[model samples]
Target: MATIFTRIVEGEIPSYKIAETDQFLSFLDVRPTVEGHTLCIIKREVDYYFDLTDDELAGLTLFSKRVAQALKQVIDCKRIAVAVLGLEVPHTHVHLIPVRSEQDFHLGRSIEVSPERMEEIAAAVRAALEG
Candidate 1:
C-alpha cells in the first residue's frame, strides 16, 4: 500500500502545496506545530531518512532549503527548525517548522489551523518562492 505522502504525491490525497519538483514536494502540515509548519518529502516511498542514498539525502535537503527560505519570507520566525521522525509515517519527510524559541518545535504538539488559513499560507509561501 502507498503511504499517505505517496498518496499526496499521486493526487489521491489533497494537500496545500508550497512547492514541487520532479523528485520532491513541499506542503503545509495539516496538523501543524505552528501556523507555517511545512513538510518536505521525497516523491519516492522511502521508509527511513537514513536509508536514502547520499544523493537523495542531499537533494531532499536542498529542496527543503528552498521551501524553508520561502516559508521564512511569509512566516514570522527566528528560524526554521528541521526534524526527521519517520516513525509516524513510513515515508521519509523533513519537517520545516517556524519557531521563535526552543519551546516552539515539539513533535507531539500541534495547533489548529483552519482550511482557509492553510491555503492562504500555502499560497503565500508559493508566491514567495516565485517572487
Candidate 2:
C-alpha cells in the first residue's frame, strides 16, 4: 500500500504543500507541534529514515535544509527544530518545526492554527522560497 505521504503526493489525500521537488515533498503537518510545523518526505517509501540509502538520505536532508531556511524567513520562532521519530506514521519523514525553546519539542500537545493563518504562513514560506 502507498504510504499516507505518497497518497498526499498522488492527491488521493489533501495536504498543505509548502514545497516540492522531483525527489522530495514538504507540507504542513496537520497535527503540528507548532504553528509552522512542516513535514518533508522522500518520494520513495522507506520504513525508517536511516534505512534510506546514503545518497537518498543526503538528498532528503538537503531538501529539508531549504525548507528550514524558508521556514526561518516565514515563521516568528527563534529556530526550526528537526525531529525524526518515525512512530507517528509508517513512512520515513522529517519534522521541521518552529521552536522558541526546547519545551516546544514536546509532542504531548499541539496548537491548531486557523485556516487564514495556515494560508498566511504558506504564502510567507512560498514567498521566501521564491524571493
Candidate 3:
C-alpha cells in the first residue's frame, strides 16, 4: 500500500502544495503546530529518514531549504524549525515549522486551521517561492 505522502504525490490525495520538484514535494500540514507548518517529503516511499542514501538525504535537505526560505518570507517567525519523525506515517519526511520561540516547535501539539486559511497560507508560500 502507498503511504499518504505518496498518495499526495500521486494525486490520490489533495494537498495544499507549497512547492515541488521532480524528486520532492512540500505542502502544508493539515494538523499544524503553527499556522505555517509544512511537510517536505521524498517522492519515493522510503520508510526511515536514516535509510535514505547520502544523495537522497542531501537532495531532500536542499529541496526543504528552498521551501523553508519561502515559508519564512510569508510567515512571521524567528526561525524555521526542522524535525524528522517517521513513526506516524512510515515515510521519510521533514517538518518545517515556523516558530516565534522554542515553545512553538513542540511536535506533540497542533492547532486548528480552517481550509480557507490553509489555502491562503499555501498560496502565500507559493507566491514567495515564485517571487
List the candidates' TM-scores in order: 0.98, 0.95, 0.98
Ordered from best to worst TM-score, the candidate numbers read: 1, 3, 2
Residue 21 local lDDT, model 2 = 90
Q: Rate residue 46 of model 3 by lDDT.
A: 99
| All candidates in order of lDDT, best leading | 1, 3, 2
Lowest summed lDDT across 10 adjacent residues in model 3 is found at 17-26
Model 1 scores a TM of: 0.98
Tens-digit lDDT string for candidate 1 (41-103): 999999999999999999999999999999999999999999999899999999999999989
Which sections of candidate 1 miss by over 4 Å? none
Per-residue C-alpha lDDT of model 2 across residues 1-131, encoded as one tens digit per residue: 88888899888998788899998899888887889999999988888998999999999999999999999988889999999988978889999989999999877688888877887888789789888
- For candidate 2, which ten residues in a row score worst on lDDT? 106-115
lDDT per model vs. reference:
0.96, 0.89, 0.96
Clashes of each: 0, 0, 0
Full-model lDDT, candidate 2: 0.89
State how far residue 23 of model 1 sits from its true place (Å): 0.4
